[model samples]
Target: MRKSVMTGVGVITAVVFTGGGFAAYNLWNGVTGGTRAAAAQPSTVATPAAKASAIKAPSAEAAAAGAKAFLAAWAKGDFEEAGRLTDRPEAAVAALTAFRTALTPTALTLTPTAERPQAGAPMTFRAEVGLPGAVRVWRYESAVAMVKTGDGGVVVHWDPTVVHPRLGAGKALAIRPVSSSVPSQVVDRKGRPVGAFPSIAAVLDQIEFADDGAQPAGDGTGVVVVGSAGGSGGSEPLFTISASKGAKRQLTLDADLQRVAEAVVKEQSGPASVVAVEPSTGHVLAFANNPAVGQNRAFGGATAPGSTMKVVTAAALLETGLTPDSPVPCPKNTNAGGRLVPNDFTDARLGYTFKDDFAQSCNTAFIEAAQLRLKAGSLPAVAKDVFGLGLVWKTGLSAFDTDIPVETNPEQIALAYVGQGRIRTNALAMASVSATVQSGTFRQPVLVPGKAQPMAARTLSATVLNQLRSMMQRTAQSGTAAKALGSISGAAAKTGTAEVGGQNPNSWITAYRGDLAVAVEVQAGGHGADAAAPAAAKLLQLGNSH
Candidate 1:
């Protein structure tokens, strides 16, 4: 009864090629619910399994034959004809449309492992898809679903995913940048480039893993489970179907200082990040990380700043007309807004000057100062308006700008003085804070100059700056940071330990030399004095060598 569908396709196609014959074929398709004319019918989106079983069954051999013919047509770029053969014609057309527009494919070819199901599953095949120039091919696994016809032959069962399993909603069979493009050479203050470090190179052109929107090339096509990690380096995404290297980009990174920072944090077991910027120009002198640069931790991590924030809080107190010599209290803990803010091993020296409290990193002292002396209502403005802490910076590269939310909770306000309670910052931001103090004004750091312009900020008064510098000088001389920074002449630094929901708190240190400002963080590395300060000293020494 359906012998006409199984007769030699060449002869059948010739007979069906006439105008009247074509219209009759379309009508029969509509009447019998065949897929070839689905586009002319109503649109329906079905899942893979639903699509596979939509059409009635024919003969097993006929289905295999139909699969072979479908692959052959699709391989030769007869997308319209091949789409007409599927249960959902619109889906196949949509896939073809994406391939043409987005993939920018020049040529494509499909080949089946078996002409008929001799042993394994039927319709398993490979698709060699070419990019713009047809110079490279992304060999993709593809197949066609075959269903039995009511009479005796088989029709191709079709789903758009037959092109690529990840081609559904929210996913696409696309071409994207695995590694970002780099322009010329990024340089330091003196025009010296940090030599090609694998870590730095990786950062310049980020190598996105396979979890991104890239499909595997040349993975097992037939007999492979859907969504399983494919081939070798399963998590590795194919950069592009073709390769086109871009111009070498330049950066404002210092090679020598970067090496010193990398060497210090390279041996650490867990994640660590360090950044060094020039105080006068706000140029990024050096950047290093233990996990090797894919995650730009130095410029854009939203980690809690911990006690290192005291430097900014101190600025607020100084602006409130409180002198460094003003007397203040140091207690173990202060409970406000039903929350307790405690110092690191807080040893209460009931009466201490503001200078002594900052040097010792007394948490409660600064908390009290934030509310009582500085006027809690004006706390947030100190960092944002005065020092440019929370303002949006126009850094050339991607950066996590500081987020210092205004605090209404007394406990939270106290926590804010100590770098907690909704206050978040990145290494670049903290380094800028130190730089602002050292330079007496804010200068936003930049990777590529002129690309990111800096915003003007309110500067500290000369007297206030002198006193702040004096306080930090005392810190390096005999306070919490003294042990690590004692050897470096003129070194002034502050240390912090931020609680990050774990057994150990994250360690941090922001330091400055004559013209250099550096910030470092060690995730879950305990006390800042023990983990972050030593690394800071080493980097400061290297930058000073210039």
Candidate 2:
């Protein structure tokens, strides 16, 4: 692998592990020279020491040479060198970084599945890599893709998953989240019990009073908590609630919808989240974090929301003199506050309306409109007063506190229109925005009873509301989200791709149909149309079916 690679042949080898002990390693003669076990090898007869080895296909010879070179580099614990043999060495290097050490397979053997291996055929191999901080070997089935080099040698067509299946830019394969022991219930809007959601489980609490008999003692107010640690599941107490006084909270989650969402999210490979609500009322019908990984990211995450925030910006634009059909400039890029903002793929200057820019997700059009049509400090009002952002929402269980701060920086203001810079929100908040648009009024979201109603923000005028809905509908029918969300009747949607530095931008989709509104996010997912929108479409289909 460190060399410029081989040509003309390929070989498939099964790396039979000797379990990485000092004794076994010396016997195998290290990486390439010897692979047979002394016990497994048959005694060789002196007579007729076999003429020449049979001729190998050029592709097979090249593959075998390539595999051996990679194995040798790996044996020296030179993963960096071995990485170079693969097509995607960058991804390979990233995945290999987790091991923090170059490792050799203690034993190796050639087990050719095909007589003469050809380029691009996968070679199955078993390797017990010497992972750092552990004596016991880790065993797994891994395959490498072989491609023909220009000189006729084969090189691995690498995927990061080859190092470890879950290893990617943002993911580390070796570490994972612990399963929750405590349980909590998520119910639908009408107070029907749903399943136990991980988000609710992460912040759930159970209280138990030591002494149960004494008149439930002082109105159950000052009981000492004992033997408790809380995080996910149903909020049922180990002891009786009348005695222990534990809280049994119900969430606005529909069981059927949650199951459907979970099923759809599982079919996808990356991390994702879905927040669905009953639009007429801000009641969550289903909330699911993809694979239920990490923290409760669905309810508590704060991401830029890509173009989805255009919903908020458009609302602000209508408040100004501009109508949906108002002419707007969406050149390739526009300057605002001395900072340039580019439309990702829009050309509104070729004669397009504000509504056209919106459906097409024109970034510069909104930035120009924001500077020319609206005054400074207007977005904070747009977010807080109209969209019900900035309020400390008490959604029964623990939840994300949404923030959309006003920006004085010209570039910040320009980017905010496209949901970059400082505009951060969770799926719950975005779903609420869609619900407000769907219902023509802002409904304060409540996960449990006793949620305080924040002061009423300025309501959207009837004309503005009609136009907003129409624009969203237009987006679903012919815009970016159309490929994913167009089939459903009476559907309206907005897709977003929030840019995160270095890695891929977060994918976002906020949509509403009839009384149901749903928001979805895919972390490090490339774009709204390619990544987030499909997840949203699946959830919507299942939500409607249920």
**Highest-scoring model, TM-score:** 1
lDDT of 1 by residue, 1-546 (tens): 001000001101111222211111111111112343342232333423334444455455666667766655454445556666666555664555434444434445555655456422446665555444422345556566677544434557665557665443333333333332332333454666543664565454332212222222222111111222212122224333323332223456777887887887786668888888888888877778878744778877897889999988887788778988899888888875678777787478888999999899988888877777765656578788766877777666678888887767677777778887778887888888888889987888876655544565578889888888888878888889999998889999888989877658898999999999999998888888988999899987766555
Across residues 216-278, which tens digit of lDDT does each residue of candidate 2 receive? 222211111121122122222111111122323355567677777776566557788888877
Candidate 2 — which residues are off by over 4 angstroms?
Answer: 1-193, 196-249, 346-349, 543-546
Query: What are the lDDT scores of the predictions, listed in order?
Result: 0.65, 0.61
lDDT accuracy of residue 509 in candidate 1: 92
What TM-score, to 2 decimals, does candidate 2 have?
A: 0.59
Q: What is the lDDT of residue 72 in candidate 1?
A: 51
lDDT (0-100) at residue 207 of candidate 2?
Answer: 16
